[model samples]
Target: MIAPVVSAPTVSRGVRLGYGVGSFCTATVNAVPGLLLLYYMTNFLAVPAWLAGVVVTAPKAWDLIINPLVGRWSDRTRSRMGPRRPWLLAGACTLPIAFFLVFAGPPLTGVPAALYVGACFMATATAYALFEVPYKAMPGEMTHDYHERTSLLQWRMIFIGAATAISGVLAPAIVSSQGANGTVGSYRLMAATIAVILLVAMFGSFFGTARAPMTGAPEADRGGWREQFAAIKGNSAFIWITALACTQMLAVSMMLAAAPYFAAYTIGTPAATQTLFAALVGPMLLTMPLWVRLSKRFGKRGAMVLAALLFGGGTAAAVATPLFGPLYAHLTILVVGVGIAGVQLLLFSMLADVIAADAARTGKRRAGVLTGLWTAIESGVSSFGALIFGVILSLGGFIESEPSTPVQQPDSAVTAVLIGQTAVPAVIIFASVLMTLKYRLTPPVGPGPDESG
Candidate 1:
């Protein structure tokens, strides 16, 4: 006999849009820092490359502690605004200010500047945990249908594409417009402009998701941390998917951290950073529907495997960019972007499935804690990309200097940038494909109540 098919109620389009808009805050916050912070630290603030990497990565380590706490807190919260939205409002009120302070462009340089930026970054991490852990948990609770979850998350992918494209291109363009070398003021302006965007998006999400449905208990499991850990340990699908996602996120992070350096040293123009990001994010916007269909036809697991290959292959091909010129590099990155659309859409959709399944099986409201663990590990692993790349740059003897004094990078340093951007990320993404193969999540095989009613 054929297995019974299970589905949840459809989410409203307005709710989807309102929820998806939050990606503007999430995508821009992630993109701008990964793209520019490393370059900014070494080139603009005159912090040593290795030290700057530590400064950038260290703050995110706080996610290990804060994300789970936020998750558990929100799960148990009882309020008129809902368990998640209050934290969303809190994040909206705080994160942008902390984010802006990170690039405030103070007079201090070297260790002092690193310390200042690190502290600001830590605050941003805390605020982000407040918003993100809960925000991420919503999709799992919003709908019970597996395919519908993919459809809902498709909208999120679109906003992520748009936000990443806008921030990646706009931020670099703003930096380049100030001067070929980029002044302190250029970074400050970029930060301020993006901060406004973050505020609008975060606040918009708080109000937008007002009508979201929750399928699980209104309050979460009151069990302590050990029980939460036990629940996580038993979910095989969550374990595999988290591993796959963390690997993919690490590759993306490394590429982002290396983008500006790749543009300046490999492609021979800082302006190329805009064009490159445009290439990388442009396909993400145009190809999302295709990915949605592919997931439907091939299944999320099959589609994810295909996407991982495309991403890894493109990244590997980009290793020869110096030989073929900028156009070739952009084309390869475009391919990577197509794969990225699928990867981003499927990963979150699958996570929602895992969350919904766990809730149904256990009859507990644990979306918050599950999402908390996912974000904590993902965020921490992503930060390592910068740390790893920084060590590579240091190994190549990369020089650090202020914007007022541009210095010639050694040939080894340029080679290190290229290798870190292309070969290293390609290897990591390929590894993610292997992890994806180990994931065998199928749709839930039953019906559910209409929480959206």
Candidate 2:
């Protein structure tokens, strides 16, 4: 028989803010690498585009193993600080240092440079899994109210927007300030600054949710990996959402990886990277409330379909950037940003619902394991965005060069950048819209439980 829903208390404002703060770390770490790392490897370090893509993607492949293990480890921990916070603390301590090293810009080029960046990035990915897998699991355990989950994640979406905007604008601006071509010294400075931000945000989140609620009892030593996989396989909602999220992430990653090339070749200025990112994220800050209300009116599945259409449409229209110029590209990306707001808000909220419902049905603490698997696949699939874009660049004969010695890209390479950034992503995002149609879930409901002290 199915267990009754265990009503969870509402999260307090301070705690909510603290939990939301973690996105500063998650968003920056994700955004900077996706936006600049590929360009950095190819342009600054002279790594071939294909090899650079491999370096960026190879480490995230480790996530498939590490994320689930971290998840299981967190699920079983008996900590006074709670199951997830200790891991958050651990990630806070490690990730910044690892991140700093990824862009330290060692005095090396080509293969050696690729190896160095790869090793450092692997470390970053591992540290990230420690925090993100368990961190994602928290909302499910925090509350059982279906609508409350959306309300709680709204704060997360807001923070995501802010963090993404800051990182997106700041990183490129720092790099561009050194030179239109960008020097190694400039990247080093950007990495160090971003690392400090990561430290503050990760630690803030570690302490912020000190008194956050948990709806279910801990199930440490619950079964082995086989059991976890079986549980995940049984959940249709989990599967569909994971598929949908992976497709969306891949599209976003591709656009991020191609941004610098798009700015330099299509938009006619290296600094346009900053403006494009600004356009891509500005709607996130302004339209979050609209997305939230839309979810309420149409339901998440319906809203998700609408959002995907907007994203796909905007991305497709951006293909005309070369013909219409920078203004057209920015306008199109602004529309993409509006859709992104809804897409980001609804996906996490839906995941929380799925996890909460699973707990109610089975009386098991599976959030960690489930989230572990979800993050693993998400990270792995998203890495392909860079890989795919790299292959496109290679096919178009993109030349590798040092920052001090800039190379003129062939017209084919420039064309590849435009298509990879816009058309490919547009196709992929529309495919995600089709996947969204397959997701079906009924939110769990019950009387409210007593508030956590």
**Per-residue lDDT over 144-211 for candidate 1, one digit per residue giving the tens place of the 0 to 100 score:** 77788888988898999999987899998888778986888999999998999999999889999999
lDDT of each: 0.89, 0.89
List the candidate 1 regions with Cα displacement exceeding 4 Å: 1-7, 216-218, 445-453
How does model 2 fare in lDDT?
A: 0.89
Q: How much does each candidate deviate from the true structure in C-alpha RMSD?
A: 3.1, 3.2
Angstrom error of the Cα, residue 166, model 2: value is 1.6
Q: TM-score for every candidate vs. truth?
A: 0.96, 0.96
For model 2, what is the alpha-carbon lDDT of residue 446? 50
lDDT at 164 for candidate 2? 94
* Model 2: residues with Cα > 4 Å off, grouped in runs: 1-6, 444-453
